[model samples]
Target: MTGGERRPVASRLAIRFAIILALALLPAGVIAFIKTDALESEVEARNEAALMGATVQAAMAETGLIRRVRGMVASLSHLTPTVINDPAACSELMRGVAEEEPTASLVAFVPVSGVMTCSSAGRTYAFSGNPLFEKVVRLREPGFVVNPRGPVSGTSVLGISHPVLGAAGDFMGYVVVSLSHNALNELRLDTFDSTHGSTAAPVEFWTFDRDGTLLTSNLDLAAAAKRVPASRPLAEFVGTGSTVVQDTSRDGQKMSYAIVPIVPGDLYLMSAFRRELTDVGGGLSAYMPTLLMWLIGLVAAGLAAEFLVTRHVRTLNRAIVSFARGDRRLQAIDLDNAPVELQELASAYTAMTESITRSEAELEDSVHQKEVLLREVHHRVKNNLQLISSIMNIQLRSAESAEAKTLLRNLQERIMSLATVHRGLYQTSGLADVRARELIPDILRQITSISSGPEKPFVTETDIDDLRLVPDQAIPLSLLLAEALTNAMKHAGATRDRPGKLRVRLKRSGGSEAILQVSNSRPDVSMRARIPASSTGIGTQLIMAFVQQLGGRTDSGEDDAEYHMRVTFPVSPLVTAENRERNEASSDKLGNDPV
Candidate 1:
């Protein structure tokens, strides 16, 4: 490509191949990603389900304990009114019952007077301000309450209460059983450890009443509260039917909690499991294989394109470039180990180059023959013009009149100038064009030698640049220069005994024009007076004619000391092969005619 030309973005075959390969694999990559996402979702769902199952299993122990407590409370409610009302006898009976049930912290019976008449610890208690007492009295049914410290037991406990009735079914009293919070926690941990292995992740268990009051927890109150979902109340999950949810704990750890009701509107159990249960590492690891496959496929495709196509294309391109830069060796491209298609293309290229080489060889030989014939023609023309000049010279020597001899001499000089032009043409290497630096100086030397005598010898100075011109411009240009020089030399004279000075210059003017100038010292006053008369002479007329033929303009003027003549013309552009052929055809049609 040229320096200013831009290579297109899509032109690189390797990159195009890589893009195509990537597009081809796009569906597979998308499918892989989708499958990986689905798999991660499935794993998450299964993990949540397993956590919910484990939480329910752990709550089973609490459920059975509550059931047994309810059965005992119901059984003890049947105590006779005489035993329930008698403080000492009822205290002995409650102590015995508390001893029989290991889970109960305190068992008490309060009569209708709002004072605890029966106690497991053998102590009298007042129920005037107890919330459980009011609840049991108002509802007249069995219920449970959570207390951080029970009034009777002086410790955190779950208070289970059942209303007692008299023989007549009248409201008489109620029975209250308090379960120790420490024992309940211990039992829950033991059940969890047995259900899940001891090495499994530690789980935090919390039990709350329908009022959102925490009853008991495996962890301390503050720590366990931190694990609860901050966005919702525990009462909101009371009847949610074994739901598992994800939330960030207050301590900034991610936790998955399963909420299961141990007693449907009375108590709830929530288990907090570690975050890893539903974590799939953000599903990035699952896409590793797809990403790796895409990379490998792109790389493999690029390599294959480079080896199979691009390398051979580059090889062919280099060979073509080398050939175009004039490397004649035709065997530069190696076809061995190339693919079949590339081999065929190389063979076709080789054939084409071979044909072009043969055509060039034939054309060169034909051009050589034409150049030889044209040079011979110029040589013969130069010889004939020289013969004509010699004849004119001999005729001038025998002339009888001064005017006739002068005229003969002038004609002879003009004939000799033509001969010089022909000679320059045949002598140079090129047939179609001549160099100004070579031919112009030679013409100047010849004219100066002929015009100089022993008494009036002239000094010539020339400044010429090398410029090539076709024969059409070169012929007229040479004739114009000869005429101008002859006219300048005719009246050249010494000033103060110095030799007559002549200066000739040929150079490029603008980028497309050339200037030729000839200047000579002015003659004596007597000779200068005849200049106006001589301006209409045959020499000046011929100079004008030659300039016209060259499609140029001319100027002639005399300054204080010297006479100057100049011709300025557009320079012919360098001849391309088409122009050269056209020039040759026109030259052939002209048939070697004298200019």
Candidate 2:
């Protein structure tokens, strides 16, 4: 397989793998989810408490500013009807007092007649009808309001005022002071770093009068007020005690706010903070150990399935497939390393494989021994036939009669044909088949050497195909071909003055049959026949019998001046190869050598 290719698994195996994963990870996932939910609740609680503390701190800072303003305004002992009767004297006295007050933007004296009499900030234009002065006049005490732009050069300030008394302690005018916004902003806390200041989400501080009037804030008061729906009053958001609330801003951004009253039944302070997930102690990372364990558990389950389940299953499948295809040489699967659940199965498979291998080894050994015996038997048979042929050759040399010599030579050729079949059996790896093309060449060469004179060197031509045949059919086929070649050479004798041609051909005639033909060009046709008797020799009769025994047919005839023989036979392995070789000791002009 290439890197881009992946083996396909059966649907059943895929389903099994999925089931294992769900079993391993489902519980862990549920537990992790539960723990995560609990952690979120705790984090929200911490945020609520932290926001409440911050709002209280900021509310106390507002209280300090208001208290300082009221204290300074109330301690103005020089502010009496006598001192204020002279407008020039009162203005000069208020200017010295304002100079001594670093926390206030201005100090002024206003008459009860709803007009500014004389005051600091050079000259008061109008402030008598201001809520701060009116509240102090009505209650006969000091009062404060976060009205930074009231009755003075427009600036952010907390307004504080105190009512003055006549000698009869009757209602008179009030002395008012403006508290500086910058002075309140300079207050520091240990919780917020001094150098870097508050790194928390910016808090917007809002202080409201008792009448629920929107006074002033550290933020753009207009924008903050716009975030509140017009249907809801700002006082509704600023109840009595410190309370943290969350809502959406006008722009749909989520917001958290803490409201606290600085003065019990009067002024109130509210701190608004933006809520963000990052502000929850950096989200999930706050509990690193728990999150890490959750991830590790998931990974471990996957690894267990990969190594102990999926990998081992694939290994077992590979071994089984190899064995089914007749290969039993694979090494045993390691049961020791297998999971406890699969160890028994692995061990059983290993035993079965070993048993199969042992049985196959024994069977192969027995077959090998039998093959050796059969080959040796063929070898001995070949040697014995050669010995018999050699003895017949010696007998023919001594025979005086032509007939006896002819008989001896015929017998010797037959022996040699049988010997050739056995020789082929021993020579090739397969004991059952002999190669006809290979055997035919050897037989023709020997017959030609026996019949040819030094003057009549007969030429042999062969066009035989290589074909395999069982020994039973091959032995008879060899004898038939030898007879054909011997007959052609014997009758078509060429002398010193004549040369001869022989042609042999073997080819597949059809899908189930093969044809063999041999023809020769003889130097003399005036002998007037096929042989001493034309096709009547013992060799021809034996040829006929061999062809019949192999369930085939033969045809022979003379065409022009050449003698021809042809055989057609089946290609069944039980009835195998065929070959024909002709030696013409003649130079007679035939139409063609029919090969």
Candidate 3:
């Protein structure tokens, strides 16, 4: 697998998990918060309504008690002056009213003489028994009192008083009726309990006087009343509307207090509310569904991610392996559905593979063309050398003198030596170097066979190997060797009876020079210039030219009946002039039109 394909699953999973978590948490948390907020708002609305109803019921009940007591007082005030002057008749009237109206705790009638009398519980009481009656008798008009007592028994009640007068419109006395506070308290408590029982949260009922004095609450009334400051800010809201809400506390636990304004704003303020119902965020039940949704969504997204990652990696791996196996023609992997990084990886892989394919094709074509050109060059050189050898052979057959015939034979051998070099080049892929040891002996043998007459027994011999020459230097050196060997064979000859040996040894004296020495047992140095001065043999002149061209020195020596012709040439050419000439000749042969 390639580097991209080898990406670890742990990293990929971590990235995917992070994305899914973000997606799940951001929306789910927001929705849950909104839902919680909505629930709190709804609960607050319900609490407000409940509080308003409780406050209204308490106010109605309290006001009705005052009104009922006042009505009773008005009825008694009309019969008061007649009944009051006669206490017995007044007691009868008061007792009859009290028994009929069970809500009235007591009844009283006071005379203009400032004496009060009361009837309750089947007994009558005199006004002198209670000091509160004295204060009421001094009143000029009708009035109501809170938490009053009966005229004689001192029974606590909510009381009201009205004036009673004679037919002459003179003030005679007053009448009083008391309503029971305990019955009103019981009714208020029952209504609050009923309203509170129908709700999921706690509900409170608070009643305060106009000065914000706490009167009633679902909590410990006396304790709550003490905690409520006698002078509170609710006095400023005496005339406000019903159902005012604010987050507050009764005894330090958090609560929402809703203040409901009662009717007759001058009397008192009644409030009802709940506590410990604020939205604290995520209800446990709500999280069950939210978590389930998040988990489901995360799983689906993870599966999709795995599929995409696997597909992209597999495609990249296939393409990479194909390229490794020398198949550069693979198509690019398409990772559009995959991640952006994998897409880039695929594109880079395709570009690199395409580049390699083009380079390989170009290299292969270049090598093929080089091989073809090399083979063509060697073939042409072989043909040209053969042409030169054939031309020399034609020249030798038309020669007249024995000297010319010998020279012609030597020229043919020189051309043949150059042909042998071409043969080596044409036969092998490497055209530049020819093995000279094998090549020289083969050339000398050809020369001996061509020049030998029927009676002559000439043999070419040499102990030579491990020698190499480049074609450029070998051609000229071959010509020089051919000339020396041919001279020994033809001019320094032994007859059949003599059976003389001509020894030819080609050896390297040092690392730098090739030494060709041809020695014959028979000594005939005078025979070397047998090609006369008057005659211009082509081979003789060419031999001298080739020797000079090779930059070599030649010497003819004799010792002990052996004639030695030693020619020493540098291992390589002194200059590239010969190479240049060869190039020009090759070019001329290639571009020249055949004649």
Candidate 4:
């Protein structure tokens, strides 16, 4: 019975339970999915701000450089020719201005007709045809020009010219500040600080004029920096507020840019990066927070299935197994802290188990009560029969005729046999079935005493294997055995010459058949006679009827030195009608009994 206990089909049940949890996580996945486009839009907006800010800050630095150059040029106008006569003094003034600004390479005074006087390099120059000289003298104000070569460095330079005005407000020579190529490049990416090598997208910085001429670029873009056509997007977008656009670069790399008009009259600042430079989608890093949250939600769902959802399901599985194995006292699952759906399931299971336990208790109580009533009825029947037997004995003692006394004794013997069957039932543990080995011996012993006389001194021997039968079957079998024993004691002789003997054996050996054998130590077939005889024709008929009722075959006669009877029967149907008859009889007795 222990080995036959069934184990849970864990794999199949786990899959079933997991599907329910998976269903619960489906909505979370949908919500995360639904948020995707909005989240990406939000991220794109922020990235645009950052890119525009980078370009603005860098352009501001360049604006600062241009401002400083104008300041330097204006300062030189204050230096007197009295100071210029002391060449050391004019050179000192010029060197001091150059050292104060990173972009300034030279500071000098150039006449309106284009002659350099009191230069920072300490040399004079003639520039009669200089366009900037004529422009500054004509305008009498600050002006700027990009020059490929300058009087000092001979490299590409930007010159800031501030015209010196006379006391009558007449424009005179110009105060010039010169910046070279190295200094202009310093302004290209002054504010964009991220390491380019570490970035996923390749970035570029460019500055262009309103007329579409590319001025300077952080990239190696000289070859690609042709004049912007009127049809290009940049031409229309130059004076607009800071904005982002997706377009192709000169090299045809797909790019997204944030463009803003930098200071100094429609000079545009642009910060750009490749849109498809990496195998992974570009600019997705900007939406990392949203993506990370989605991933976290997914991971949380999996953990919840393992720790919270599936764990409770497995617990329920074990609880069911224990309860089915007769643990009636098992506790109900706790619902207070459980998930809502699981709590409802647990509540249903608890109610179902409690119902089963209540039914089992009711059934057990009903069976116990039936057994108690049955035992009581059997005991009462035995007592009633005994009273009748007692009355018969008294009548027999005073009977006048010898034949009447003999009839009374036989009647007493039969009544006693019936009484013994009740005694067997009442004494049984459940008051239900009777054991054949036990019942037969008790019946035979009583009959032996009834038939024995001091002169007869009947001898009996027995060997019976234990078997159980119910009251109805026991009654007939008991009567049969009593009759046989009575016959053995009366006729199968006893005196000192030959003592009477009866031996009975009942057994089953490794098969479904039961055998009962009774042998008397007397010659059953002899005309000359052996032992003594008394005729009782009714005993033979009674024995045959009882055997037929038991569904058994019987043979009785002489076998060598002993007279024997053997009954053979199947080991099934030992109870038969006995249980049904008992149930009906109990119902009647209980129904009629007063409280």
Q: Name the best candidate (by lDDT).
A: 1
| Model 4 Cα shift for residue 378 (angstroms) | 1.9
State each model's CA lDDT, in order: 0.79, 0.69, 0.62, 0.70
TM-scores for all candidates: the values are 0.60, 0.44, 0.38, 0.46
lDDT of 1 by residue, 1-595 (tens): 7525899967789989999999999999999999988887887777667777777776667767877888788878887366864678888888888898888999988777787768897777788877766776887877777777788778888878787888899978778789997777777643343223354566688888777877777777767888887777787887677788888777777887888877788778898876764454555776788899999999999999988889999889889888888877878578557899999999899999999998677666666778788899999999999899888888988999988987887777777787888888898787667888888888888777776777767889999998888778878888888888887777786543667889999889989888899999988776667554544378878888988887789887888889898889888775653367655755654565566
- Deviation of model 1 at 468, angstroms: 1.4
**How do all the candidates rank in terms of TM-score, highest first?**
1, 4, 2, 3
RMSD to the true structure for each prediction, in A, is: 8.6, 15.0, 22.4, 17.7
Q: Which residue pairs in model 1 clash with each other?
A: none
Model 4 / residue 589 / CA error / Å? 13
Off by over 4 Å in 4: 1-12, 15-314, 317-321, 335-345, 400-402, 509-512, 523-536, 572-595
Q: Per-residue lDDT for 310-388 in model 3, tens only? A: 6677778777877787776667477767888888888888888888888667555554565467677767887887798
For candidate 1, give the lDDT of residue 423: 85
* Model 4 lDDT at residue 442: 88
* lDDT value, residue 248 of candidate 4: 66
Candidate 2 lDDT tens digits, 343-415: 7777788899998888668545554665577789989999999999899999989999988987888788778
